[model samples]
Target: MTAFPLLDPALCFVILTTAVLAVAIRTVFAAVVSFIVFGLLMAIAWVRLGAVDVALTEAAIGAGLTGVLLLSTVARIAKHRADRGDDVPILEGPEPDPAPTDPLPGLATQSLAIVLSAAVAAALVAAVALLPVPAPGLVAEVGSRLSETGVESPVTAVLLAYRGYDTLLEIVVLLFALLGVWSLTADARWGGQPGLRHLARPDGVMAYLGRLLPPIGLLVGVYLFWIGGYRPGGAFQAGTVLAAVWLLAVMAGLVPIPKVSGIRLRLALVIGPAVFLAIGLAGYPLHGAFLGYPPAIAKVLIILIEAGLTISIATILGLLVAGAPEERPS
Candidate 1:
């Protein structure tokens, strides 16, 4: 019998190599960079798999913002080490000596991990290979009912109409996660400035780039949101772009961070989820089901929700990367 077709040769090689480097690299900095590279590559894989939404998400959040966050943390950790007199630029744990440890994973643990990984991979391959040709799916169902949601994009229609609860819970989960991050703050630092205070030179490349990038990024992000009503982009993906721009400016010291306890900041944080819940509640009285909207205004309501979610998501993502506050609660 003929063997099933193999995975893409070049993509497979790169993914495997990156996967190894991400885990096997000795330095934390190298590992993080490797992981970021891996995430970008995975985004490409998602594109190849015909998932534009997943691809956008993977690139923006999984790769872009995550890389920034790790780099920021690594920089802080490195600075803390250097402040204690170590002159090396290499990344290790929070120690000054910087003595190197074993670069490889333990033999037993590595073996077990490899075995589990291979088993899962094989199972997935076999499942795909054995799937019936032209397997039944929800595509027709989605397409047929897309009109009911009053949205042009089937993905958007399903997300806001057929599965609105899932999206609502997702927003709540993000806010809750941020709350957990805040919980880690020292009591005195509650509501203080979040993340490290960057001090970029006035004429520095970072400062210039920070000033330059946000305008373009903001336009692109909003464009994504605007087009998402009938395209692959959406609030989450667009919000990630906006969040990244905010982070860039903050990291370059082109902007200041506000105290988390500020009423405006607090309001910004909660507005999206609050609006979403209110809309859902209104649905019961107006449309007879939670999260339901009048057929005539379904599209408009969805857009309104997306707009609010975009703002909230951008703030949340930026703050989450900024991590817990570190100064006095102002």
Candidate 2:
């Protein structure tokens, strides 16, 4: 029904090819690069499917933040190997030769893996094929009650109003995950700045972009949060952008990594979920239901919640990528 029908099929093919390459690639870095490409392609597919909110989230978190995290991991692994005098190249070329003691998967194990993968693929195909024609969904229901949610964007409304509890839990999960990472820090390094301090030449491209991009990125991130009330932009995407901006600044040596124990840093990490929970509790007194916003000021409440969430999400995401503390506090 649309122009350029071939576009969808072509995109799908590329996506599948990239996915295969991501898993089949010999080098971890190459596979990660392929995975990032696959994520970006998936974002494009989401856009073509008329899910712009999903597309933004996919591009920002799935491709951008996740790719950076994986690359960081690769760098760390390479550093560790070098420290141990392993002579293994983590990012470039093929993996180091396997130790003679290392055993490859046996023929039976490989066969079982192949069979399981095929079974899973067939099950997924069956599920899609069995989906009802016209595919039952809550589009109409969400539309009818959209105004009451105090957001013009259905995706925003669903995330912040209708399924707010789930969103809250997701934030909490991120916090917990970050805590788990922090717990991995050495006792001597506890409460110290996260990851390693980055050094870059002041005249280099990274330093130049770090100086140039933050102001623009800050504006865009805030705009995304504000526009979410009426469009396909929201806290998650905005936070990811802000996180990337922060990471860039740090990597360019424009800003120092904050101590994990810093009061302000800790506050920024919890403020979002705290605000959401506070609002939810207040709703019990105001509307006899948790997370219920009073009709008169629902929009104001939602905006407040999103603003807090944006800050916390950005902090948590940046820290997640920076990883556990590696240096003792000064």
Candidate 3:
């Protein structure tokens, strides 16, 4: 029924190939790159399935942010090994042999892993095959009451209005995650900046992009947030854009990294969840249920919540990428 019949099959083929490559590749960097490609392809698949919100989320957090995190972790590990005078090189030349203590898994262990993977795949296929035709879903119910949620976009309505509790918890999780990252800071670096200070040449390409792209990225981020009430864009995608901009600026030496313990920084990190919780609690007294928005001002309330979440999400994501505080320069 699709307009591009071959397109779907081609995409699926490529996705499967990349997934296999991601797992089979010997180099960590190559595997990570393959994984990122797979995430991007999956985002496209979501779009094809007509879930634009999910597509945006997959592209932003799944591919973009997660890829960066993995790449950074790999780099850090390589550097740590090199600093310790291990045989491993720092991201260049041939990979060193695995440490004797960390030998490859025996054939029995490999066979067990293969069996478990095949069993899980078979179970998933059986479950899908057994699903009822037209699959039971709440589409009709959601559509019937969508107007009451005050958001034209069903995705936004579900996230910020109908199931606001889950959204609030997600933001709280991000706050908690950032707290966990901060906890890794050493006593000597307890109040220091959250990331290493970059020193980029003023005339370099990175510096140029840093100075230029942030203004454009800021506009895009705001647009995505503002349109969420009526379209597919929302807080998570907007926050990711803003966070990337901040990270880019920092990496290009256009701005100094903020200290993890700063009062302003802390406020920025918690304000979204705090605002969301306060509004949800107020709903109980006003509408007789938690997260129940009264008809007249429901739109306004949703927008306010999204605004708060956008700020908090952006700050938390940026800090998460920046990581825990590092020792101050002597």
* CA-lDDT, candidates in order: 0.87, 0.93, 0.90
Which pairs of residues collide in candidate 2? none
Best by TM-score: 2
What lDDT is reached at residue 188 by model 2? 96
Worst 10 residues of 1 by lDDT: 89-98
- Candidate 3 ranges beyond 4 A from true positions: 90-119
| Residue 132 in model 1: lDDT | 91
Order the candidates by lDDT, highest first.
2, 3, 1
Note the clash tally of each candidate.
0, 0, 0
lDDT of 2 by residue, 162-181 (tens): 99999999999999999999
Q: lDDT score, residue 88, model 1? A: 67
TM-score of each: 0.85, 0.94, 0.92
Residue 238, model 3, lDDT = 97
In angstroms, give how far residue 106 of model 2 lies from its true place. Answer: 8.7
Instruction: Report the poorest 10 consecutive residues by lDDT, candidate 3.
Output: 90-99
Winner on TM-score between 1 and 2 is: 2
